[model samples]
Target: MTTPLVEMLDIDKSFPGVRALSRACFELLPGEVHALMGENGAGKSTLMKILSGVYTRDGGTVKLDGKPVEITSPRQALDAGISIIHQELALMRDLTVAQNIFIGREPRRFGILDEAALNRDARAIFAQMNLKLEPTVRVETLTIAKQQMVEIAKALSYRSRVLIMDEPTAALNDAEIAELFAIINQLKSEGVGIVYISHKMDEIKRISDRVTVMRDGEYVGTVPAADTPIDTIISMMVGRTLSNETAAITDTSRNPVALEVRNLRRGRDIRDVSFELRRGEILGFAGLMGAGRTEVARAIFGADRREGGEIWVGGKRVGISSPQDAVAAGIGYLSEDRKLFGLATGLDVRNNIALASLARFTRAAGVLDDAGMHQAAEKYIRQLSIKTPSDTQEARLLSGGNQQKVVIAKWLLRDCDILIFDEPTRGIDVGAKSEIYRLLNQLAADGKAIIVISSELPEILRLSHRIAVMCEGRLTGILPGGASQEEIMRLATLREPAMEVRHAG
Candidate 1:
């Protein structure tokens, strides 16, 4: 066998309270795309960070081209011919494409930047890659896909012998993904070892040469991508099999509609969309990325304005000019970007729990009733089984799933009957996801109308009573629960369907 390009053995690293990685072993060979697969908190990112010198390993041996070496900083990693493209694009929006690609080392003529030469060099590199994007375009004006390409192009410019891509296709659509894969194939052909990090099962199967699995900061094993089934991989990541079971809700059509949205429009993202949520019904809103599902949620929540729309809550038309209005009208909207809009990450558990309904805890002379607040927070902590060191633990210190539980507790305290859960299980673990699913089921059973919007098809199939797939700001189709993945994919792809739904089982 040929010597491996890179090898990290028995890597152990830890943070203040988290043992991020233990005995993790990873090896990559030249001309191969090795996939690092795990759940969100599965230590994949931490392991890679250690490899790239962003985090130093307390115990491990790293080999470069069969020689053991210690990389202590990002500069040292780059000097060792290693480059990482982070999941979050880090380009400066004010800078031009060429400026962004070569920000640290600008081309200088007589100690002054030569604009013409910069563009010429950038254009030459882009031409070699068959990319047609203009070198002079501002980074802010470019789309997410184009910005990601620039990151890759910059990494290539480093003449990096090893490349790392973390969730490269998270923001990209089908065409953009194909282009990225083509580039990866070209890189592989040139014997540049690649390490792909992603949670997406399909992408791993499609592009990976070998697969490594990690669970709870521990390395499981490595296997051939072609031989391991997705279910097996998921099991290795989460310590159990994932249930893609579609559960049925008994006859929600007989129930009265609790929330009705008519002709909802918000800029170009959402247009002329309409839907109804029946009491005790879990309505699944399905769509591809950038398909306006989230826009509808934001407009309904009054987080964003709508050009045209009418919202009716429990047979009464209501004005939702702001999020407060929506809340007063008994509606709860959970933004998909939870860290940005959902919970108060800075506050403690008890405070964040009572945040949405502080008025209910107010006593004589406008003073907060500590006893009442504590009771309410305790009730939710026990009911939701929230994991925390104590009731006073900071919300930001909790794991992603626990923080989400706190958000749910916030809305439940508000006593809102109409709940809109946008990507509720995003970045959540499989076990926690099952718990959230059960909570949603119980809420619907208690007659609170629910609308769930998700990008994951299997999740929609499993939890929804009715599936409403959207494409290009229009309703594509509405199907019954237990719909096959193929059925949802068909409706999801239809740009202009002749009928409301295709007849499929």
Candidate 2:
């Protein structure tokens, strides 16, 4: 057998408040897809960053094809045939696809950008991937899936020996994700090594040849994907056996409609979607990504404008022209991109929790009430069991789960009756996910109309009183909460023969 294409030995890295990696080791064979699994802030990203030379390792050696080498910068790593695609896309939104793809290394004919050659090369590559996209299309105009494909195309252009994908399927639909796996398989066949970083367990079993688990900045163990059970892998990642704690929701009969959306249409991306959220109901929106699940949530929250729709809140026709309008109408939105939209990373806990309801904490003289803010923050910190040394801890320093709790606390403090939690537990660990689930149940019990859009089927099946399936920009079906994963997945991907009415088993 050929020597492994890339091998990291005893890597150690540190930051001010964290020892991100400790003697971590990773190996990738020339033609194998190696998956890296870990909870958020478990040093998976840190290790990969060190490998790609974005962060220099304080200790340990990285070997390229059995030969140790110094990779001090991104350019050096790229020259050594290593590339990484980050979770938050790094593309310039205003630039054209071709320009963004070939940004720094644009081919020049006589010292000028070879625009024709750029588009031609881009088109050629896209054709190989079975993607039909105009190279001149502004990245801002394209959907998230299309932009993800662009990121892949960019990574491929480097002629990389080892490619690292961090949550590549986070925003991709089933079809787009399938296309990506096809390309990954093709790359594997062509002797290119891959490092897949994802939280989705099923994907690990499907695509990975080897699974590496990391916890608290240390390498746990490596195992063959086929031999290791899903629970075993999850257990290793969180350093604890996770007993699936998703509780069966109680029957919520006799609840009145808290929110009713009718003919919610916004351009071609979001079709005629309509649904009613009942008080004391956990309604789940299930779909393959780009099924307009998030779009529907955004439209309902007034984050995006709907061309035509009628919304009634508590029997009153309401105008939801903006997020502020929606919020005023008692709608709260927890966006999918948490870091970008959810928290103020630099702010302390007391301030973050009080952010949404600042006016409530103000004195009669219009001055901010610091004492009230602290007391309110303290109440929630204990109520939610947020892990923090003090109420003054920076939001950025907290773990993923705690950060999410902070977001929830913000909305809860604002007294928003209708909450839209989009991928609320995406990067949160198993323990924290359970906590979030319990919190959701409690929220529902307290009569908050909850809309949860999660990609994970088990989550949708567990906490939802009703499940709504979406596909190709439409609500396909709504099923009872006791539905199985297959049942929700089938309807989520189902197109023809719309099952609008819930069918009894």
In model 2, which runs have C-alpha deviations exceeding 4 angstroms?
247-249, 269-272, 345-350, 364-405, 429-431, 484-505
Report lDDT (Cα) of residue 450, candidate 2: 95
RMSD of 2: 2.9
lDDT of 1: 0.83
Residue 369 displacement in candidate 1 (angstroms): 7.1
- Please report how far candidate 2 places residue 58 from its true position, in Å: 2.4
How many pairs of residues collide in model 2?
A: 0
Clash pairs (backbone) in predicted model 1: none
Pairing residues by index, what is the TM-score of model 2? 0.90
Per-residue lDDT tens digits for candidate 1, residues 320-362, read 9999999999999887756669878898898998988998988
RMSD of each: 3.7, 2.9
Clashing pairs in 2: none
Error of 2 at 386 (Å): 5.9
Give one digit per residue, the lDDT tens place, for model 2 in 1-505: 7898988999999776567789999999988999998877678888998889899999999999899988999999999999999876888999999998888999999998899999998998897788889999999998777888899999988879899998888778678888999999999999999999988888889999999999888999999999999888888987775555554566655688899989889987677787788899999989887788899988888888899989999989999989889999999999887777889989999999999898898888889999999999999998887877678889987766678889988998998999999999876766667768888988888989999999878788888888888888888788877888887778777774264453321
